[model samples]
Target: MGASKVIHAIYTDDDVLMSAVKKIKAEKHHIEEVFTPFPVHGLDKAMGLAPTRLAITAFIYGTIGLIVSIVMMNFIMIEDWPQDIGGKPSFSFIENMPAFVPIMFELTIFFAAHLMVITFYLRSRIWPFKDAENPDPRTTDDHFLMEIPIYNNNQLELENLLKETGAVEINIVEKDEAH
Candidate 1:
């Protein structure tokens, strides 16, 4: 199988990296990926990435959890166990609401937390015991990495562009299967 070709550029500063990205975009170059040591403010906007809907999804999921908790608690407590164990009234939903508050709150929290985590995991394509693809280890430290996939085999032109954008170092990555 033919390995995919990828160009890697290392940057020391986020500002410089952003500037480089802007320049590259102006020249109509395709930016495959960008790796940074820390989250850069407004980077997503600069890269034209859509705003994340995780918060909205989480709210909807949490609301579902809360409603399910309330309904389940009311059905179990009022219908199944109508006995007033502690002299508490259980004939009316309003009266039994106070007694069910603890379970309702617990279930709401449980569902919200668990569902949010699962949503995040699924959305981010991450899971337990799965090895992640980290393009550059230096991105976890202080270095920034910008990967631009050349579509027309124009390394010389790309090298000039990287040089003009103040790229500290540029390298080519070749992959081979070990096993």
Candidate 2:
């Protein structure tokens, strides 16, 4: 989409923002996006957005790390190097598993953290050297902003609805294409 007109409203309280979301969706207006300084409970339910899948990704990454560590350690310590530096049996992969656990746990946490961060960045369309598309700076501080895109004909109706929902301030903004 290029240069779509947007109506933005800023709220001071999260409860007021949540109430505005419910009210706007109930009246059948399309909410383009909502920005908040912090996570607001129940906001996703109000917006009808599904729960995030990052937890699933984290679990998969951790499982992969665990399996890889176990396989690598088994092959290296058991088959590759049959050492008896301290009378430790190199063939006992099961018996030596306890010593290998710290590395496995560290690898699991490393993979989970890196993959989860990458997933979140990609999902949010953010990356290195990419400019953030924050609509209002206040949204990063004490304000919650809801951006609702509407047809020109529905502008007045949307404005009226937002006013009724306790929006502290509202504006009709026009977005211009970058290129």
Candidate 3:
């Protein structure tokens, strides 16, 4: 297939970008992506994107960490090598559960935080030494950019709509079909 045409709308303010996105969606245009310097509130919902499942993964990781800490503590303190301190014998995990609570909590947090970051990076297709996919470098500073793919020869209509919605600059770029 030939290269696809995409409209890049640059905005100086996030409010204008949000309004443009809503207007484009109202007109049934497909937005390929949006780049922003900082996280915008409610932008994902406005883009019609689904909620993320990162929290669920974090909970599962935390549970696994908690279970690991419990098993390790049980084997070390109760089964493998038991010690008596302050006239109390470490023969039962339940009897000494209080001392293990801190370790369990720490491990849970550690696993949740570290695994959550790794999962986010993997899911986003980000890796060390990878080239950036950002279309405009200004987006990393203060500008916001919205990318909409042209379909059915509606580029003129989309350009007019973008201008009406307060896009400071509109650019038509030929996107490589390979991507």
- Top-TM-score candidate index: 3
Mark the regions of model 3 whose C-alpha exceeds 4 Å error after superposition.
Answer: 1-3
Can you rank all candidates by TM-score, best first? 3, 2, 1
Q: Which window of ten consecutive residues has the lowest lDDT sum in model 1?
A: 170-179
RMSD of each: 3.1, 1.9, 1.4
- Write candidate 3's Cα lDDT for 131-176 as tens digits: 8989999999999999989888999999999999999999999997
Q: What are the per-residue Cα lDDT tens digits for candidate 1 across 83-143?
A: 7778876787788777678877787778888899999999887998977667789899999
Candidate 3 matches the true fold with a TM-score of 0.96
The top-ranked prediction according to lDDT is 3
Q: After superposition, how far is residue 10 of candidate 1 from its true place, in Å?
A: 0.8
Alpha-carbon shift of residue 47 in model 3 (angstroms):
0.5
The lDDT of each candidate is 0.82, 0.87, 0.93
Deviation (Å) of 32 in candidate 3 = 1.0
Q: For model 3, where is the 10-residue window of minimal lDDT?
A: 1-10
User: Candidate 1 vs candidate 3: which has greater lDDT?
Assistant: 3
| Model 2 C-alpha lDDT per residue in residues 1-179, reported as the tens digit of each score | 63378889989999889988998999888787899999998988899988988899999999988888888888888888877858877877898878899999998998889888898999988899997788899999999999888675788998889999999899989865572
By TM-score, the better pick of 2 and 3 is: 3
Model 2 steric clash total = 0
